[model samples]
Target: MFDAVRNNRKIVQIFLVLICLPFALWGVDSYVHGGGAGEDPASVGDTKITAQQFQQAWRQQQDRLRQALGANYKSEEANTPEARLAVLNSLIDQRLLALEANQARLGVSDEALRNFIARIPSLQENGAFSMARYEAALSAQGLSQPQFEAQLRQDLTLQQLVGAVGESSLVAKSSTDAIMRIEAEERQASEFRFPAAQYSAQASVDAAAVKKFYDENARLFQTPERARAEYVVLSQEALLAQVKVADEEVKAWYDGHKDRYQSAEERRASHILLLDKDKDPAKTKAAAEAILREVQAQPAKFAEIARSRSQDPGSANKGGDLGFFARGMMVKAFDDAAFKLKDGEVSGVVQSEFGYHIIKLTGIHPGKQRSLEEVRPEIVAELKRQASAKRFAEAAEAFSNMVYEQADSLKPAAERFGLKVETSGWLAKAPKPQDLPAYGVLGEPKLLKALFADDAVKNKRNTDAIEIAPNTLVAARVVEYQPAAARPLTEVSAQIESGLKLREAAAQAKKAGEAKLAELQKGGEDKLAWSATKTFSRLQPLPAPPAAARAVFQAPVGKLPAFVGVTLDNGDYALYRVAKVSQPEAIDEARRKAVEREYSTLLAQEDFAAYLAALRARTKVEINQKALEASDR
Candidate 1:
């Protein structure tokens, strides 16, 4: 289990499975259709959920997702209006719960939040909190210290709530047994599918039927709610692009830091140590002296002498070669003597800690100065970085003022300042615009607070220059608006058509497969006709890949309904009859332990949901729907 948890691929699969598990309880089929007054964001004894808190939590969740998936993250399946709304509502629900938790006074202390931040790897250096690193990261993310603190505080509060509920959860042995039994059980089955295409010939769509369907579900075709927005975005990278570094500045910088470019002297030398003092000190010295004299007479024979007589085991095997090294890299006495010798020169026998060593200078490398031309590129980069920092600050301040002064119209401000007015219609404020580098600023608590302010909503006015991030300010005003309403048939006709086509296909497939299943059960058809396929246990690979198999397994096992029919992704239908079900049994000890852990998790989740519900039922909540709509504009 530990190994599975440690494996990257396994961990990822587990994480995804865990994330999806919530849908089982939440009921994925319960969808938010178009819009209406959603359930109260919160409901205390007398107060209701407020727009301000909802937006705040919503923005926080967005930031958390961005942080988890990276700035470039987008949900591939959520591009359509329905899918997008589903994701947005899920985020909103989480926020609602978090706000409720806060109102119930289920929050973490400041000290706890501080400790948590300090322990985070991203904010630590060598296992300790690094103020410098924390500051730099906050700067990169375009966040102020206070903003980060507030976010951390809120997160801590939510965690506290979850912890409280989870702590109270209890898992009984019987519950674990049940879960274990299901997890380890296997099912035997066969399937038949009924294809809709088979029935298309018999099922004709008439104009009158189409008109009736459209009339009954007219709301499905209505246009989606949309709001026009005029927003000013400040990104450091954009500001940096306009900054230019001068050659003179680069040169001056290079001059000031010239000392850093100097290279140190290095020596390449070898020794023929003809001594081993540990055995006999006097004899070792005499042997060294003798070998030194011999090498002095025949200098070129030093390499041969080293190989045959040197007492240094490692270097002796390699002709006593000590590869090139800087002054401080070698032992003090050996280094001093070697450096003193000129290139290709020999030295007298020197005495030191190991023994005595006759040194020879195989080569000498002189220290040299690195010219300014060699490091001009580095200098230029430094200058540009400095210039960019200044540019971003100035541009941000100017951009903020412009948006604040010209609230309703972005054209006037944009044209005058040569700045582009970015427009986003009904964006949920998470996984923000990919093209805008500073969009993370929108996640800041202060920016959320200001954007949802009553004045900004009532007047449909631009937000004041609010610092969403360091060196980045944002101000936005609504231009166009649409109150949430049930969608009309015209607007959702295409969507309904697609849904209808899929359901029809499934229905047709099931009908045909049902007949096939009945024939197979009557022992009238070959098993091969059912498509030869691998049989799987309930705990094995998910049957999602084989929808027909899933449908058959889910059906009650009975002789009367001897077979089940369903559609497969390959545009085919399949019919399956129940073969046999393994008797429900207690799990083995090992499996039981695992199931116990899972049961504990399930209980905790249930408790947490209940806790959130209770919190929402007792909080002071007020919402400015108009303010929320205005900010998007």
Candidate 2:
């Protein structure tokens, strides 16, 4: 279950973002301004951090945190003083390093910046950078070309500094070999189970004792407040049904975007490849000729031969089929050969950078223009989308204005936009996945903020229209409010009783274990009298109990009479009076080699940290401590 989620798209995306955003400092703008932002946040090089600067940096950090966490974002946690202080400190540290980097004249060239920007996926379409798209995206994000470039440059600079450190760190063969050795080795062992009931003849807790224990820790049985709320949602999707596209508009759209309806010529082919690299040209020629003869002899079995003998791992599984690709997408020689061959025709082995190939033309598709009549429906839908977007925007603006002007009942605003003013029954401040009727729109930050606003809260008025996402808008009002209250004992009697029993049992166990340990310390050692508990190494399976193995290896090491108490998984406690502690010696040479590889990786990590520290030393940095602290304020 855990591994499945780890590979989920959202989880993987979050993991990559977390890895790249922080400690790695892999984002943009770390370099151009300076090597790093600064050495420390509060007092970098004797400069007091200013509140304004700290707030700005803190906001940016908050944005990064939000981006990284996505749906799991906790507004309160991010807005807290501790989080603000942490962000401020990071900003100061970056400033210090960036200043030092500048002093050392560590800069990125303009060409590098251009290349970096060009490579960004967001700015590309159809495998080529789109200037129009690049501009539109920057505009949407409210960033100018120069501003974006400068930030990118700064980011590149910081990366270079970090990369420099990583590159200098060498991975020793001895280390890698040790690691490889362990990876190639395996261990075999047997295990046994010693269940609690099997080990202890009688272990019980009385009802009276359970009740007493529950009285002492009653809070454990209490439940957090829960609520069911109602809301009204408005979004572009809601308005989509209201939009209409005329037939004339569809026809005009199709005529203007005719290129979109054109189909390019496509060809399907298979090949057998031969390579000239690392072998004599004459020898390669001989092998190609031999293979060609064999293919010619059994022309129908070319695919089977390619599947078994082709050197191209990428396409071999599909019998060396390149699928259908249009002209200009492949290398000149390969493209020419495939396009010239008729369906079912085979060509002699062709050579390219990867290798030589026996080409077989399987199918061909001729280029053709699509008629407007054939694509009219699609064009109409597109026109409707454009029209709908404009209409929705206008409706959204009107909705916003109506709420702002009225600032009272949602009835007025809702009537104006023909949207219902929805009300929630009650809602807790704790973040939750939207589950209310009108929550689709009300869950947005803007709507939530408005609902909590003094005007809305005091008058109990509806919130203004808020955009949750493109085209979606929502308006909501809180019908009733409830402050959190402690749950009554009667409401949680069963829970309390269960918790009480667990506590009483744990207490009893701990008392018995403690007395047993005291006796052992004095002279309870009668080898046969001592109790035995099975233990396992890290990553090893435990005996039948289904318990984790980490605890076994983490237990204290000593002879009999030494006791260490640890809480059991079931909330009970156990004291292990050490009879024996097994020491796991290092693995043999084969395993040792694998360990070495890991040790080298560890060394590289250390070296990288050291490099960052050095870069910090070289930068001339200053931080406004006062400003940073003010971020929390």
RMSD of 2: 10.2
TM-score for candidate 1: 0.45
lDDT of 2: 0.59
| Residue 510 in model 2: lDDT | 57
By TM-score, who's the top model here?
A: 2
Q: What are the TM-scores, per candidate, against the unseen true structure?
A: 0.45, 0.58
lDDT tens readout by residue for model 2, 506-577: 666656655665674566753333344554433344542333233333444444334445446664445444
lDDT of 1: 0.60
Off by over 4 Å in 1: 1-193, 201-225, 262-370, 394-402, 405-419, 423-458, 464-474, 490-505, 527-566, 569-572, 575-633
Q: Give Cα distance to truth, residue 594, candidate 1, Å.
A: 20
How far in Å is the alpha carbon of 346 misplaced in model 1?
A: 9.2
Q: Please give the range of 10 consecutive residues that has the lowest summed lDDT in model 2.
A: 186-195
